[model samples]
Target: MHAIPVSQSLPETLDPNIFSSPSSPKVGSEPQGHITEQVQTIWNPYKNRYRVLASCILSFANGMNDSAPGALIASLERDYNIAYGTVSIIFVCNALGFIAAAFFISTLSTRIGRAKSLMISEALLMIGYTAIVTTPPFGVVAASFFVTGVGMAMNLAICQVFCANLANNTALVGAYQGAYGIGGIFGPLIATALVSRGSKWSRFYIIELCLAALNFGIAPRTFWKYEQESKSLLPQPASEQQDRERGTVKRNDRTKRQWQSFKTLMSNKPTVLGALFIFAYQGSEVAISGWIISFLVQFRHGDPSKVGFVTSGFWAGITLGRFTLSFLAHRIGERTFVFFVTVGALILELLIWFVPSIPGDSVAVAFSGLLLGPVYPCAVHVFQRLIPRKMQISSLSLIGSVGSSGGAVAPFMTGMLAQHVGTFVLHPICIGLFVCMGISWFLLPKAERRDE
Candidate 1:
């Protein structure tokens, strides 16, 4: 793509020294001119494309890591001679680690640049995966997974925030998030196929580590180049400028403002509602994705290889749905699209629950993916538009953390249900959950204005 030139509209009187350290702008200075110029430059159509690609790479990594454990759960249980309940504890630990990191590590990213935060996350992922591959004790394995979760939380929070900032037109945020869903579709299929062959699960992590490292290496050059070109296009401060030399004061103020912005985001009803949508959607998706193998093998007497294909079909449906909706959402409107998708998902889940035979069950599960795919991306698009630009990261982080928690909760619940009520009944409960989510989406107040 051709590079879009930065806007040349910055105020003439701004001190040249401001360009020296883009990291720390002077405190107590009005940022009107700087903010405007930066928005104009960074919001170019070309920059959004790069950001979308980067976001996709991050999503691909997320998929590989997220899908690996569930796919390999039976193997781990067999190797360790552990009960299903005991095995499920691994996911609990992973979720706890993600929750902790999302609350704390995500805040740190604002202080250090988003790029630096992502680099650190990738490095930690490498270390965590290495620990897992070493065949440590169960306790050690749990710790390694926990660390991986931490890295994942940071990576997810930063990438979502980065994508929001890069969006030029409000209508395209769904398209950007759709790229993430596309990654989710492929990551698990590839990971599961590798694990099924008796290949070491650690190899999957190693591959992901290499991909993340490459992304880290290449992103900075492009991001910085974009930053420089866009700098002149940013708005200048409207308030009197502080002395450019006082770096400490500027840093302190920025930190304070970020915290305050976080508070405001937490207080907003629309933000909370948007997060609930993510939480519900992810819970439904993970519950089905994580347990489908077990359901087929234990309840239907299906082979593992066939089970993997069945699960993969679901993901394939999701990928196709996301790719199509990325462009289609612009024409249909997000609210209407979300309502339609959720209702369809609800219907599909019910079909999966009621179907008695393998053919019918498989078809329902695969079709569910298409119906459920657009819910997440559209919800994210809504939240991004509702919240202010500066608060986008904190808002996305908070919602993402909640959403990840849902991912954890659903699988854990399914495992428990499988242990008690019998594996065959889990599908019905999932159908119920989708119905509730669809009802909620339908009832959610429509956006009062297009640009809100």
Candidate 2:
């Protein structure tokens, strides 16, 4: 039998399914088969710009929330008359919230859609900030952080999946993560200024509350009907359509599928390694952001007012790196770029550890932030390519949310150790975590070049 010619159409008399085989393309299916190849680029002016903008706004607020703890920790301890170990409960609660969100975010996104999920996240952040601003008991404040963490995790998982799938993903991911760095910069600055000026540490959340309120409106407006728009922009795969048409699917199965996705995510080598890499990366980042000030104040005897600015410096460097150095990741190849930066960060961390002077240590901390900054976006870009596309959202949610628990675990450990050993413990912990990052980075499977 002769092969069917591309120029010829299938006969009207014959059923198209008769020509279809598992190993062969079905008659008249070539154009439809190529639908999966179509993708949305960041340059789409009709809608993606607005979506990206909304994501950035959400990220900026998250940065402010995460970094503020560093600037406010001292004041919190003073006001509550709590020791380092006690003040660190906020990190534990925040991590618990993130871990809890990891379990439900995928389901929430599926059931309610991205827009409503994001709006709910913003609402949670607002509530958390409101609780903090009231300057309630330390336990209540810690619980408030748990609420914020749940909200932040939801936004992070959704935005990351969206940004990672766009064209020019590395650059876009960099820009997205860069927004977080910018927020981190201002978080400490505002918090420090407010505290130094005789205002309460909790007063800083007033700014965060305002930002969350803005995002609450922006998220729904920008992301409303997002799933429909995305389907229109990038048509669904035939497999996905088939899955939908199965009609046997029920709302109850969503939970089953989510658990299966988690299990599948854990079994993938790249996913597991990626999670570990983020675990180390964020662990070090938050440890430095949360503890560097105490180190400076204790070891160098630096003034609390002036030294508090160091956290802002560190975040500024992170912002600069994510924006500027991230361009190099695409050129150098994301995998190679990550190795160089991780090594650079480790060296700088050691310097921060041993350096005797406040000025030198502060500069090292900033440069360390600069080196560590692009690692996240770059790693995320690589993970997107390595993981199967269908699993990307749940995989990234696991990688981001569960992995980000390191931000809490590491800092909580640092706070506890600082109470016993002194703030100097931060440098060694950070250095060790950097080494873990290196190892995890090395273990990650190489991402193959994706077809356009």
Candidate 3:
């Protein structure tokens, strides 16, 4: 394929097909008005810059919304008069939302297009946040959690896919995920400050609501009319659209496509291993923060009021690790570095579990987060190269959803066990999960290309 140079100034009327990819433009296509402006708007190099900005916004919001609960769980327990076991059920609801979104989001993306589907997801976030901002009834609050989880799942799936496509290489993708770490660090602090001041915990959600609303306005415009729109805008022969539809049947068509995509994704060796690896990785990672404060307060006898901030330090390490370690992963190679980081994390997990001092455990937790930080972006980077391009988005979506469900399930089970045995189980369970992660990584199909 040869490149077509976009003009600095196209004529008043030019072929609508001029916006097509490097492939030759179709002849006899209708000439459209304002072709120059459209070219600058859609195909300009600066458009990707704008998309990167959108990706950061979504990443920050993702961290803020998901991580805040780590800081707010105590407040939720107190305000709702719930037990640890009961509060853990909320994690199940959230996981349910992520699992449910995984099954249908690819089809949704196919039907409405990714950009519009992303906008709808953002809108769902707004509604969920608004629902939670009030000191509502317990049932209402729980339902709100489910709604917000659905929004987060869809946003994450779309965000990962969009950025993977837009990023030129692994380093760029790492930078994008680094922004997520920064957001995750800030997320808990926002909630902690409000709680520390004796303000209503519900007020914490107000900030999330505002951010969601801002992204709701910006993301659609940033991602408007991606791949599908390109097909629609280019002038296909009049017979082409008809010929394409003639062979397709309407009956059960959408369901078949979703199931087929799911099956294909699950059947791929690299995809299955990648998904399982994340399922273990996020499971272990989230379990640490979700249970760390409780572990400290209940078992380590750390001040109940102060231990929650320890989660901030944990996420801060994650932020710094992604920001700093990503560059190093780029230099040392992602696959090799990931193995070292995971093993290092295993050593740190043991320190947290066996050392048993509040200060020692806290430091170990932060260090573990640092070691674990680069894995997510690095995994996404590998998937981009390893998965067949045709199946990338669907496979990645499944991986993301299953992985996020792991995040929910790990913490939920920890809470259930904590209910019986006590929070002392936190670090040991985390250690075991990380060990499982090590085995999964060993089984993963190696990428054909090495990191640049």
Stretch of 10 with least lDDT, candidate 1: 1-10
Model 1, 131-229: lDDT tens per residue? 777767778888887887877777665455445444243334444445555556666677678777888655666677677677777554344444344
* TM-score result, candidate 3: 0.83
Ranking 1 against 2 by lDDT, winner: 2
Candidate 1: regions farther than 4 A off? 1-52, 168-179, 224-232, 240-263, 388-392, 450-452
Question: Weakest 10 consecutive residues, lDDT, candidate 2?
Answer: 1-10
Cα RMSD for candidates in order: 7.2, 9.2, 8.4
Per-residue accuracy of model 3 over 1-452 as CA lDDT, tens digit each: 00011111111111223322121122334344322112222134455568767877887887776677777888888988887877887777777777666556655765676678778888988898898888898788778878777777776666554455442545445666777777778877778888888998899888888988898889878777665444544444445346557965354764565466556666888878877888888888778877788878777888755777788788888878877887788789878888899989989887877787998988888998898887887777667567764465456655776787788778888888888898777767777887887787788777775332
Which prediction has the highest lDDT against the true structure?
2
Model 1 Cα shift for residue 83 (angstroms): 2.6
Q: Global CA lDDT of candidate 2, please? A: 0.77
In order of TM-score, best first, we have: 2, 3, 1
Clashing pairs in 3: none
What TM-scores do the predictions have? 0.81, 0.88, 0.83
Name the best candidate (by TM-score): 2
Segments in model 3 whose C-alpha atoms lie over 4 Å from true places: 1-45, 227-242, 245-261, 450-452
